[model samples]
Structure formats: C-alpha cells, structure tokens
Target: MSPTPSPESMLPLLVDYIVAWVLICTILFLGAQRLKAKIQFYAMQSLGLSVLLGAIGLAHQNTKALILAVVAAIGKCIIIPLILRYVKRRVPMNKGVESYVAIPTTMLMGGGMIMAAHYLTNHLFYNQSHLFNEMLSTGMALVFIGMLVMMVRKKAFTQILGLYVVDNGIFCLTMATVFEMPMIIEMGILFELLLGVLVMGILVQRIHDSFQAVTLDELEQLKG
Candidate 1:
C-alpha cells in the first residue's frame, strides 16, 4: 500500500498551487480592460494571498500567520475592493480602459516577466525552503506586472490598483523572507495600506470632480 503523505511533505505543493493561482490572477488583471474587472481580479489575487497565509499558518502552527491572513482578507480582499467599487461609481469618466500599450503586447510582456522572475529566484533561494523560492518568484512577477500596469494604463484608478498589486507583492516577499515578524509590524503594514487606499481613492475622486475626467492624459492640461 502507498504510504500516506505527511503535511510537511504536502506544504510545499500547496504553497506552489496557491502562488500559481495568485500569479494567474495577476495576469488576468493585466489583461482586464474594465475598472470593475480589474478590481475583481485584484480581489481574487489578494484572496489567494490571504488563503496562502492561512495555509502557512495551519501547516506551521503559527498564530501570527493566521492573524495576518485574517487582516489581509479584511483589508486587501474586502475593504479595498469596496473602496475601488465606490470610486468606479463616482468617477464616470474613463468608463473604457485606456493604455499606452496594446493589451496583447502588455500580456506578452507580463508573460516574459513571469519567466524572468522564476529564472532570477530559482538560483538565489536554492538553499532555502522550496516554498520560499515559489513565493519569491510569484511575488516578483506580481511586482513586475503591477509596475507594467502603472506605466501603461492612463487612468488614475488603474494606476492605484497597480500600486496595490505591487504592495501585495511586497507583502508576499516579506512573508517568504521573514516569516516571524512581530504581529504589530504586520498589523501596521495592513493599516497603512488601508489608509493609503482610502486617501488615494478620495484624491482620485477629487481629481475627477475637478478635471471632469480621470485619465492622466486629460489631467495634462494642469501642466505649468
């Protein structure tokens, strides 16, 4: 009879699966054209991240991981998305997505960056846990794609979402590299993100109200 697999043995595979799901969500976010679709993809990616943290907590019996997972879910998955939806409703301008690069070209760039991320991390974290390597690679991919979105997208709202994606990447990298951070620090990071999102949302709404549009192109008239 085949022997039963231990949780320790399965943990790496589970982590890889969740990270891959998050990466896929990131790619979908890159391809998404509508503000609503982008918000949904970002929420899904963050939900995967929260789940990844929860799984790590369960496998390692770490209370901090569990707390962080819950906080991430509340802040990234729920509250942030709600704020985005509110912004979408208030900002009637730029209902269609606008990008400096075509979607196909952006997707190709995103795919290439994912490969580059894996290639870069594969050697550096070879001595560490395999799970660390997977998480780091996915984190790098998220950051790359997020920055791409910020650079190519013309809308303030999309850029804000891209910033959130980069933030999420940083979160994953922190967890992979330093899993035992103080609970207060973790809570502080999430609180700061929540506060930043709120402030950015308000600012975006103000910009739309003032300029009558949210696209960066439209705001170029403010140039001195």
Candidate 2:
C-alpha cells in the first residue's frame, strides 16, 4: 500500500524527479568512473528520463510533449548504446579509470553546484517563471558540473562525455523549463548528438595510433 500525495507532497516530488533526471544526464555526460559503469549509467539515465517525460506529458496532458518524450527515450537510451558498442569495438579507450579529481570530491562539488543553482534561481532569478525556472537552474548547474568534470579529467573519452553532459543539460533546460519546442528542434538535437558521437568515434582510433597508449595525460607533449 502507498501513502497518498498531498498537494504539498506532489509539487516537490515532481521537481525532485526533474532534478534527478538532470543528475542522471549529468552523470552520463560527466563520464563514469569506470568503463562498464559509464555505459550502464548512460542507458539507465535515458530510460529514467523517458519515463519521466512520459509521465509529465500525461500528467500535463500535452500530446506533443508526450511524443517528444518517447522520441528522447528511443534516441538517448537505445540508439546511443548501439553507437557506443560500435565505438568500443573500434578503439581501446584509456579512460574509464579513476579520475584526477577523484569521484567523491567531484560529487561534493556537484552538490555545491546544485545548491548554487537553487540559490541563484530562487533568490536572484525569482521573477522568472514560477513553474520551470528551477529546472533551468538545475540544468545549468548540471552543465557546469559536467564542465568541471571535463576540466579535471585528462582523458579524451571522458572529455567527450563531458560534452555529452552539456548537451543533455541544454536539452533538459529547453524541454522541461522553456516552451515546448517543435518536434523538429528536438530531432535536430538528437541528430547533433548522434553526429558528435559518430565523429568522436573515429577519435578513439586516432588516439591509439598516435600515442600508442590512449591516455590523454600522456598526450600533454603536444602542449608546447
């Protein structure tokens, strides 16, 4: 048996779900601490996002939004994995190991980012839309966290993951907080992410061939 949702209980939970969605995307984009873990996390996050979007669409009764939600699930969750598998077959990634910043430390910073986002969006940007602005703030924070992850981690593969997070953050900000963009816009984003992954897919081979070891840290010789 489940406890019923009071009006008060409902709103925060919804916001939390959106925040959780952002976190999932952030983790996906920020790169995983381990290779197998990152892949699994990405798949799980996409699935979670898909479910949330579907629920939001139904709850809000926005037919177009629901359709877009389904599209996100398919693209982010399934298609990306297939592409990743192909990439994996081609290159031996030197990333997916312990990071320079350390996972626990990065998490602490990420927590700080969420708090800062809330503080800014709540007090400074208070005049913004009452409904979705918080989500926007959360997205921004997640993007920033992803950026930090990229900066601190020297691995090229992880850097690409950071880029992925930034994309997801923007996508979430647009879809959840801003106006419901046309389906074409969402499709464009999916296409862009696909292209990025495809292009970077080749980089894996380049890294292995050039350095003989794929770690970006060793590539620092190029830093004249």
- Please tell me which predicted candidate would have the highest lDDT against the true structure: 1
Q: Which stretches of candidate 2 lie over 4 Å from their true place?
A: 1-3, 6-12, 21-32, 128-131, 178-184, 187-224
Candidates' lDDT values, in order?
A: 0.82, 0.65
Worst 10-residue stretch by lDDT in candidate 2? 24-33
Clashing residue pairs in candidate 1, if any?
A: none
State model 2's lDDT. Answer: 0.65
Model 2 scores a TM of 0.73
CA RMSD, predictions in order: 6.2, 7.2
lDDT of each residue in 89-155, candidate 1, tens digit only: 7655777779999988998999999999999998777787688888888889888888998899997
lDDT of 2 by residue, 82-172 (tens): 6665565556556355477777778778778877877877877777764467567766775787688668777665556566556555665
